[model samples]
Target: MPSSWTVLAVITVLTIYFCKNKRYRWFYIFAKTFRRDFRGFIVYVKTAITARLAKIRNETVVSVFESLVKKHPEKAAFLFEDETWTYAELNKFCNKIARYFRNEGYQKGDCIALMLENRPEYVGIWLGLSKIGVVTALINTNLTNDPLVHSVLAGKCKTIIFGSLYANVVKNVAKDLGFKSFYQFHESTTKEDFEVLPEFIDLRSKLSNISGDILSSRERVLADIQDPLLYIYTSGTTGLPKAAVVTSIRYMFAARGMTFVLRLKSNDVLYTPLPLYHSAGGMLGAGQAVLSGITVALRKKFSASNYWKDCAKYNCTVAQYIGEICRYILVAHNNVEPVKHPVRAILGNGLRPQLWKQFTEKFKIKEVYELYGATEGIANMINLDNQVGAVGFIPWHARWAYPVSLVKCNENTGEPLRDENGHCMECGINEPGLLIGKINQKKSIFAFQGYADQKATEKKILHNVFHDGDSYFNSGDVLVNDEYGYFYFRDRTGDTFRWKGENVSTAEVEAVISNLTQLSDTVVFGVEIPNSEGRAGMAAIVDAHNSLDLHLLSNSIKNNLPSYAVPMFIRVMNSVPLTGTFKLKKIELQADGYDINKVNDKIYFYDTKLKGYAELTKDIYEKIGNGTMNL
Candidate 1:
């Protein structure tokens, strides 16, 4: 038995020893993150954990939303420009949607595609449809023509509810589609401002004529946690958009995790300008309002110039972003005085380390909850300690609790490296490898609801991970974790390449180029160039119709994609050479690179100074190669 003073001395010595070395900082980070998440965890538990954990196990997005609406009926739910809607008002509107759809005979498991832009009504339509168990396929508003037609048809949607703004575009494709009905939603009461296409049913007037009361017992039973709720489209590596099935439990997980990890307050007004069709805006952004009773301010679309101004106008305390959104706002809104802005915190991913420090310092951001996850992938991580460039982390002492790992894999192809015993090898500290998460049915956080396509879903699963019989979700992302357990996103699978600090999916770019070229064959691939951090995009198109207009193509590319996504170079050919299997000979084209001396095709460079695609001259090509030309 030692003296009290001696015991205290020993405890102090042990504490100091454990907190020693710079490499042993995981203990501090774990404590900090745990303390920060404590409140959210308690609240989540008090709210009955999740739809999966509830007593009835019948918990769902609709039921949880109903609970929040009942609890905070008078609270402001959404603010869009000059309009504001209380939780009660929003709920009533959603009820009308449910009633209308039910009365019209839309049954459980029915699908309706929504092609509306970001608006309060957009949220209402999806929420309401979910009440009667109809899966809403959130179509990207930026898509046009063939790609738009593919997105709608992929979901097997018999009906499509589009905004009045997209009336003409929808009308052009209406004949091609097999939709039973086309419902049009007017953005304003003065619908005369926009043409009401004769083919579209007046959804606004129809909803106005229905009852806004709660659903009748005889109407329909809402969805279960395991049931499909929404279909969110993710750019597929194969081609076209893949409809990812977002189950009710999956939605609950995203919303609850965001609210908890962000430590959102009831008074927090979130300003989200990201498109609503994506999960970042649809599930996480809108979920904050629907699940937690927080006020959300909607933006029609992202305007970098108006980023902070909107925050100040909406009295927003929090903001949301994704991809190059932070970079866009940082560069475009450099004149914005951060001191006067009401935003104190930001939530998003895709902010590079160099840009992270600059953006936070310039904007006076106090907290940035940077996150890493996928729409269909199971692995999810968040940066709670504001670790620069780190997507998220799992402490070394608690990796068992996380069920995620970075396994050694082929750097280019992303195939997991295996040992002689047929077991996957885990990457060591600072070594980049494929990030994977174990699929456990009992753990809802690690549960992968997967995409709507059975083949697509099966393609993402990697088996025999660690044991003889084990499985993991293939994230298709290469990540490096340091000794402190901070995970940094390095790169993605070979098909996807990083450009301007953003992942550019070749398949998606090719899809856009193919459509823009009047259904001509296209091969989009990333080409490495001197004085570049990542690969630069180069697209090769087959001008089958010989109607390719360089100026029009340049303008369309700008409108369709982000600055980083646009290809820097273009090659025009009579036909794209194919491999033995009838696939585009990407290997041959990629090996050819962008060297003017090596390829016989007519090449053109996207010259920013000239503001259009210019035929590649020998001198100009040399300038690009020598780093004199800034892509």
Candidate 2:
């Protein structure tokens, strides 16, 4: 993949010495590798070039989408269920949203939170708000109670627009939210959608009163490409969700980056069932229709049984997924024409090696475009060669140019390991190490925008990394690179754990559980189950008197946290294992997990059928570990 043979030969020899891989199988394999690596490098260069030109032209998310509306007016911009919205129609919907906010005196710097289920309107609302330079916070629709309230407040939002389905939830937390306005939107327009809880305003009614046309020049804010557009929240290593600022520049880089990587065509349709709050579904998926003039097939939510049917129905050429989608698709009964679907390529993160193989084979997929990145950091990677397990690859020679690298770090403390010279050490080939990205403030694509919380932002930056004045964005994830230069995700070295395709903070769960159980010394962690893509939640609490109320704990957790954050297993202990310093020691407890043979403490499993926690017997443990129970 080198421009010169000398560099390529040197790298080949080094790869052979380090990886100890068998000799290159055949000439055809070598030819294929050369082609893929070269092509991938071209994509990286192209993406950077396009992003820079957009910045120079002062193009933003709003301006880009407006151009597309004029270029492909009748093209299907989004397909949802049986509905299809053309590029022009989608633009009209967004115009109404922009006009409403602009007319209400929402200034350029105003911020509003939006919580809605995945639909065409979800993208429209945020994009519309961007027109007036009003940053829109994309709140996870699954959040409830305290987490939900925290999200709205974390964005520093003065107003919130929520879907009608969440009216009761918003009403309960309305008093907690002391901010200005509340607007509820009902997806259905055929029925009377004016219904709202008490003082809440109906967004649909307001929009209906206004003309759904393009905003006048005088009506718009002086938007810039670098202006903040969306506040997408992520649980970054701590308890509550931290809002990550996504500017028009950042969104364009990710969206346009994929356009080049996938060699996307105008006729290609993208199927995205993932949540709009997450970057995958929001920027990468929806960004296609807005920026690239491709059609996007949006779903309200993922349905394993209907996945393939939906793909064939929409004639989708591409599909999106996360870790949990693997279990869903593999375990489903069957979708009509499961193997005959038109989906050829997949784009998403958290697809394990085994899942990648099974998924591609089952669906006869031509390519699996596995990717890796975090919400705030800019260490983006893409698996271009369709390597079975690799999340991405960085050629040895390319490291000099690429901003990302793996550095030796303490697995326990989550700190980079420095040498006697006080410099971070690079991991050897195939060595697991912490991934970091060099921050370049001038380059929007390489900048670490960090979280809305500046203190939290500082927590993620490692200063004096390799040299005196250099700093790097510490991506809490650990990864390993092979002799072939392909990177594979190893494990996360933080308190956060992934479940149900969402990041569940142990600190958050502990707080909620401890509060419900009379201030018990509760510790929460993740436990691994065989055949599961991600870890399952488990909690340990001190209850020497055997007075812990399972019913109350279950109800409280369900009401406070998202369903995924609720622990699947709970262990009752007389006292939690603590270190000599009186800190809760989670290492051994997480290792014991819910194994009946290993865990001597009383263990209980959340019984969905019973609507409460039930004693975790040996039989129940066996059923869960062996994949026999669907519960």
Candidate 3:
């Protein structure tokens, strides 16, 4: 047996070795994260108890903002470009807007549509509307023509407040939208075809007479927590966007929850480039700041080239992101090389498992708080253990409080599979299935505030999902929970399909392809093969400068993915467009298929004999169509 000194020496050596190894480092982080989360949980319990004891009612976000304003009057509330607004300044600005809305005869429960870019004004408008107990419909700025009109109408918004940036687009839909009033901000073009309204500057100029008092202001209304605050539109994959109801309670929970998750302080500066319309940006980024008395640096758009510079400029301790933003930064030569930045933690979703370590080490970030939740979904998962690729954990100890369960789902139909007894089958550990959250109104924590459209809301709820009388909100996302109770998001049900009698996850394939530095952007979808029984994997790639090496790419993909999982077809283009929230626009790509004549971009397919991609010519297409080629 070794001596005590020798044993200590051996333990020290092993510890040093494990610390250097990337795989073993997470154990330390997980330990620290676990402790921090436990402390935060205790704080949350105390806060909840205090709120319950106080009988907090008719409490709006404005009340919370006002409280924060009192605490940190001189602190920077918003930092946009070269401008900065203090807490008191922002409060007074919101008060003026609230007064103006009241003067315009806007009442409680009235819906107002706002189509603006990521700016201080956007946040101001949202807060101003909320202060007056009015629900603001945050319309996606990318929407044009019919989709724009449809989103506003779907929310039942009588008034539209748009930015001058979308003047032409809004003008096109103004006449058909039938909005009772229209307002624009900054350089709007007037059209005689429709009823055009004055700019926000004019309204602000007229509202100088309004009082800025918080408690005594007549414009301020005491709104119940259950009352609607925002009508956030969802990404319209199948049809026009549906407005999701976001209650004051849900918004407050998100703000407080994120603050707890990040362990944020009043001094923490959050830098966010994501659009304000998205929940990740609205609630977690700026919203968290509003509740915590922290400063936020809001960027107009995400620029990979300037990301590091912006973070350094703002002295941001926390940054917000989606996967595409990280991928873009990693691909950019300047960003791939290390640069000085103050960002310590990044909070958002869609960080790929493969790029997790690379992103952290390259950027020198401490935490990557990946979260999984829809704008209106009842279920929300946050990764507290710094677990790579996991959206959240469902520890056996706490699973009772968070009643989220995964049920078996058919990959082909994209629906939850019901057992013979008419009960939804719950998936075992490590099994990918549809995730559902129990909706109990009495509990409040598990409550679901669904889409504004009643039919759409009804479509998302799975009645008697597991039991005969219980209700569950269908997440429409497939996830796999491990034996440790850590849940990993697999893919959206609609994005996964059956191929070669196996389920192919588009996200999994995309993660593999995204490993290539040359491919700036990529979208994966299942395309129908003429002679095949099921759909074949296809990738629409954005390769600027067309510098992708086919042989090297084929080998990398082959090593990363299974034979059937490998995308059989590749479409290289100058650009691959993304939606407003930075999600891939795959509907058009799926419709276009692999038709060479229909698409302007170059198309290629795996040539087994050549062991690389080859030009997809008409002759090759004919051979594949007739089952002469074995793919």
Candidate 4:
């Protein structure tokens, strides 16, 4: 028999040999990152297996919630500001809301539009509606005017429930939506809460009844796993927001996948400040907590100033975020150690490469579960190893099982390029391309439950992607997968532009510009240059004071952004146009461009020699048109 010392030497040699191979290294690192106690691993295995089986076999999200509630009735389910609600308490609250919904003659299959901010009532109302098999249309709270009306009307909402803060905005469009019922609720009831128009009914009065009828009646309407439980609005970039169907099964799969992948436990507390109207907060953050019987700390709105303090106060082991949130937090505090908290992991989408390592190391975050998915997207990814700049990784063996794929695309047109045979070609490794997911109708699990509009739904399906009759859900986002199967988000197809023989991600450039304290908001896009081969970067900046120091702004951009990515033209405005979801409305910006005659905003051009922004007068514009003025 080999001695203990001899065995140790052999193992060490093997470890050193394996560490040299990238594939072996990734596997070893993954195992090390996922390492847990024997008992914990066993529990994870059992839970994952059970959840997978349940998801595959079609399980309702409400059933899962009820199961957890029964298992841990006394457990704290949610923490919002100074208030805490246990499973039983939340269950009772939801029952009262359900009762009110039932009294209004709402039944299974009904759709109710909920246009409210980030509050505990948002979750309660959604759960109550889900309990009665009524689909809840989560409208973006920031929406008003046409977009707001369009969303509510598009969903065919029977009623619109709004918050007090948006009373005037909703009132302005009340005549347009007079056909639908309206109800209002305030974050806290005051004299202002009761000062709503007659058309807007107060929802607070209905909350007083706590009969728990839905619980004991045993006659509550239940939906199938495949039935729509929620209608989450997509961030409308080009048009009005489309309501994406969130089936109970989709929620189940997402919740279970996150719980299993993150190793979430009952003791875990997720501090979520992302809006509940979106999937990241409403589904991923809340769903994981429901399935794992963990607590979720809610914030009225995401405040970079209060983010760390809230995590520390709540003892949050896990936190959620978006790319903007992380960037803002970093920019808000530039100290060596920006935050000191109990957070072990931060999970969500949109953590850019430039801010990933900087934010993590500075804030002392151990892991970042960078996620990638759309409200209407068919596939998802989760980073497990805290890989800097990677959205997620797929193990070699599991690649065949998942429907995700990347295909070559035309960056300028935001379209997938096809071969001579009219079939989409898969992109080579490390080459950024359109991310898509296979839609197999035969396999229910692979089927895409698309938007409520059939025309809109059909538009996203790409036919004959690989072969005749084969379809794939167009993700509309550009990504590249490394040799180790780690995926990095490049940019959205529409937001990426080719400039100076290179592609520039508007999101990346925007992140850099956002770090500047002078600019409150900015929209970056490609604009036409008279003699240029492709579009040149142009930024529409919003500053309240409108007194931007061109030299300072130019210096900041030069230090952070690439030469090609740097905006050649800058337009200063009092306000930045934004969609309901806070996404930049760039259509008008891109159209107006640098034409001083057409645009009223002040425009400046980068002078190569001067190394700063110079006013773009009519003479300079004419010179540039004549190809005399250098960029």
Report, for every candidate in turn, its global Cα lDDT versus the true structure.
0.82, 0.87, 0.77, 0.77
- Identify the superior model by lDDT, candidate 1 or candidate 3: 1
In candidate 1, what are the lDDT values of residues 1-631, reduced to their tens digit? 9999999999998888876875356666667667544543454454336544742567788888889888989888999989899989998999999999988889899899999989898989999998888989999886766667888988888799999888987887898896778899988878567767777789998988998988887875656778888999876456667899898878878887788777788889998998889888988998899888889999998898888889989999989987468867776766755546788788888877878888888888998888898888778888876888889877676677667999999764678899999989998989999999999866666777788788888888889989978889998888999876788998767577767644567887887777777755888888887745568899988887678998999998876665777899999888888978898887688778778899888899888898889999999989988967778
Winner on TM-score between 1 and 3 is 1
TM-score per candidate, chains pooled: 0.85, 0.94, 0.73, 0.74
**Candidate 1: where is the Cα deviation over 4 Å?**
1-48, 55-57, 335-339, 497-505, 508-522, 527-536, 541-566, 572-602, 607-612, 616-631
Q: Candidate 2 or 4, higher TM-score?
A: 2
Q: How well is each residue in 150-197 modelled by candidate 4, as lDDT tens digits? A: 788888888888888888878888898875567887668666535766
- In order of TM-score, best first, we have 2, 1, 4, 3
lDDT tens digits by residue: candidate 2, 71-189? 87999999998999998999899989999988888879788999889999999998888888899999999888888899888888989999988888888898999866788888788
- Candidate 4 similarity to native, TM-score: 0.74
- Span of 10 residues, lowest total lDDT, candidate 1: 39-48
Best candidate (score: lDDT): 2
Query: What is the Å distance of residue 269 in model 4 from its true position?
Result: 0.7
Where's the lowest-lDDT run of ten residues in candidate 4? 35-44
The list of candidate 2 runs beyond 4 A from truth reads: 1-32, 192-194, 333-338
